[model samples]
Target chain A: MLSHQLMAGLGLSILWINALLIAGAALRELAALRARRARLAGPLLRGRVEQGLGPDRAFATHTVEQVGRAADVRSGIAIHFSDRAYRSTIHGGTLALADGSRHTVPPSDDARSEVWIAPTEADAPPGDAALERAWSEAKQSRGFARSLDRSIREQATIAVALPREEGEATWVFDERFARDWLARREGLAALFIVLELAALAGATAVCFVGGSFESVVTKVGGALCVAWFLGVQPIGVALSEACRPLHRAPVRGAWRRP
Target chain B: MSAGTATHNAESRIFKHPAEMRQFGLVLTYLALLFAMVFVPATRTLPCLALACALSFLNTVVIHNHLHQGMFRSHSLNLAWRCVLSFGALYPASANIPSHNLVHHHFEDEGQPDWAAPERVGFKWHLLNLLHFPNVAGPHTFNGVTRWAALYGREDFRRQYTREMVFAFGLTGALLLVDFWATLFFVLIPQLYGARCILRINLIQHDGCDTTSDYNHSRNFVGRLFNWVMCNNGYHTIHHNRAGLHWSDLAKEHEREVLPRIDPSLDEPSMALYLLRTFVLRFTRPVARAVALAEQRASVPASDLASRAERRQSIEAELRAAP
Candidate 1:
């Protein structure tokens, strides 16, 4: 009877270890997901680098079309910096046209009027010595390109370059806003890692704490569990990419500044 | 679409043409074989479990690689392998091949433009599971709701969702006739395990995602032990970087980095605690921050796809440029 109990306990331990193996698989899977996210850490739209020191030297715009949206604004145009980009309604800003005439339009009353924004600077292009160093450093960071891409694609176009001295007479949109956002996200990434690990641990603990065939099955059944947890998107992506090759976009390398 | 455009599109896209007859035949064979395997009496649960896990994982990896067109350039051959592996793996076939392969692939992490997300990011958001919620997020209702509505919808719902649900129902019916525990061990547990695995990884992949930047959204981890089990899935950045590269060649394509050893202590947190913490702290806060950051930096000049025509054009252009 004692031997039977011992045998049962040993079997359960093996089962629990198997569950941990599953959990470890989940952790391993996470590595791929992290990779996929890294792939998307930059601008999806391919645009040439507009050479310039600041907005005065280089900025271009495109007219917005008023079709199929809830927003009411009519006049919309895009702006470009070296790597950053934005689209804005021609509202309340001086449009220094190629013809040299400055036109100031009032902000639109339309609900759909979005002031598209990018990170193009007016005084110095990102390639300049001071900006170049910052770019290089930022590139080395895990998520610098992703931050820049988000800022470039979604936010309202800022007038100033990043890492500016406070005294500099530049109408700089706050680039740190995105960095702060990414910082919070980095914390989330860490949390996700922790959560995945815990799930594995929990499953293992449950098997150890509970001595039942169900526990054993759960543990043994869930081995390679960790990999499942981490690689869902890649699996989905692999599925999607495989099943529907027509839909995939070229995954761009995120611009790491360093 | 011009002749040049059609040719370019054909070259760039995964499903350049329709699936061939041999491929369909192979898929059918795989499906028949998988279902037949379930009905087979288990000689021993542990051995079968081991065998099934190994086989299923291998099939999943193979199918995945085939789907990416990373395996072969010949469309017919790619389709043949996809059918064989997916069916052999016992995954619901019709849904993933078409919906995932056709639609989601077409969209590729599109936020507002995706037909999947009618509202984009608004107050009504909750990543829905077949337009409803699952029990997994009971502890973190809102985040669970959002995660389900947002991520799940993107991950599984849109692809083989309807078909999978039906297939699961069919599986349940079939299991009723077979030994309940046998069904549990062989079918239910493995699939459930796989599902959980998918969700966890999916969340992490796009969770702290930067919507604007393409680079930071995904990063490759350099590890050999993990890669061996997952079939070079560790090189995901490179896989995405060159989706056409075969699974066998994935490791060779990317420059590897040194990764830290796995810490056993790190795996100590409970699921409930981890889920709750992620929901309360990670999900809402970091996403908000990323959005805010994008908005702040967006003040610079850039392009916006306001019209469907433009969006399609841009999408097509982006597809053309994709490696």
Candidate 2:
């Protein structure tokens, strides 16, 4: 009888594992879609940086975090700015994603104050392969010919509305910051994966042992609270890791001035 | 091209090409092995199980080629063939269309992350990259495939993909139900091995290569007999360059276009030798360079496995720097 039950559970594991694979897969696609749509949802505008706006200006502090140089994190010096919008959004440069919202440059000290406008991809939203391909090519070139910032700007997935002129300040990578941020992202992702596994196990066991309705509901519910408020930020990081173009994110070795 | 090989509209015999016959024979041998494992109890030894796994791994290679160019001319026959191939590797064979052809092959053009880029894994022991890769890649491929099928703007693709999922799982599940222990040990292990090995191929073929260069984009394993066993997968550069070209024709094309321009280091003589040297011996030039750069940073690679508690211990440093 024990053998029979064990065998039954083994069979069920196979079925459930495949079920998880597809479910995990579906979640990933939804996350990538959310990533693309998140920007269009108006920047999650938590902070604003501007030129010498007096104290009490709403700073988008939530959007910017100092991540130490983790394994994948590139080491570079970070410079802090005093302007309200002049965030140290990583000292290399700040990536602004205001589609068709005229990327304003911080007025140049010289007469040649030029700003680069990101091409409008909002109308189509790269829904097809051809457009996605074009966006990918654009990413490859951002570091070469175009003078764009690192991080999101390098991806060219979103336009860096106002480009910063080079030689602004000598930059050095804060490994501590990049590593700190990466560790949090990876740690949170692993935590979320553990939570999902717990939920999967609960769901499987409840079925196997023949659960009462109330007990089943409580077990599964308590096993997973993905939409709940228990751990929202880490969960977001984890899901983002699943879909974000992490492997392609190339960090420059140095942006220090000659 | 379809008329030349396809039997649906021709007076010719089925699968006249030598490569065509080889693929069909291999698939038949795999099915026979599956039968023997369950029925012939004496064949259930360690060597036989390993043989089954190797054969199952080869099944993935066969399906890769078979998916590219259908072995059978008739659509229904091809579908049946696909169901068998899918079960052999424990995945929906149709997934290659999305995970491989659409994404990995079109790496440069797609402008998205190749699901299995080697950089995704960073461990001191390079072998760990091969193991940890599937954890990151499997979800990306399956997830990307779901989106690709829907956004692909084709109803047939959705239908076919769904059918494959059902058939592959249904057959495997039935076998498990028949005898769980036997299937788990004899059959399922081989199936899982095939799936994992196939995923690792992405790491083996592309790691550390200049992905942007036309001819240098992919490393090739050009051993003649090795290519015969691998169905000419060794000639990889030209395969990526001209994806639609049949596997049989890759050798000649590699000789013409790739051999002249490809870096000699990129043209490895054997996949087995390359893997043993790169992952295990650690004497390869790349490994030497990494060791030289961080002779004392043994703790660095392992830091990739960081935890919240471990990080929180450093929170003071984190907070101090966060102005």
Best by DockQ: 2
Global lDDT of each model?
Answer: 0.36, 0.53
lDDT of 1 by residue, A1-258 (tens): 113234345443534444344333334334534543342343222222223222333222222221111111123211111212223222233334334444332333223222223324322224456444444443231112221211122223333221133432112222344334334434444455465456656654554445553544544534434234334323322322222111112222222222
Candidate 1 docks at the CAPRI level of incorrect
Cα lDDT of model 2 by residue, B1-323, tens digit: 57655643343345535567777777788878887877676777667777888889889998888776677656677777888898898778988866776567655213435766766555546665665556556666775665445431235666777787788889877875665445655787688678878988888887877765556667799999999888998899888776657899999988877776667777899888998888888833253112122213323232222332333224223322320
The complex in candidate 1 yields a DockQ of 0.02
True contacts preserved, each candidate?
A: 0.00, 0.00
Q: Report the TM-score measured on chain A for model 1.
A: 0.28
Candidate 1, superposed: residue stretches over 4 Å from native: A1-258, B1-58, B70-110, B113-181, B209-211, B256-323
lDDT of 2 by residue, A137-196 (tens): 422312111122322222232222222335432121222333344455445455565665
Highest TM-score model number: 2
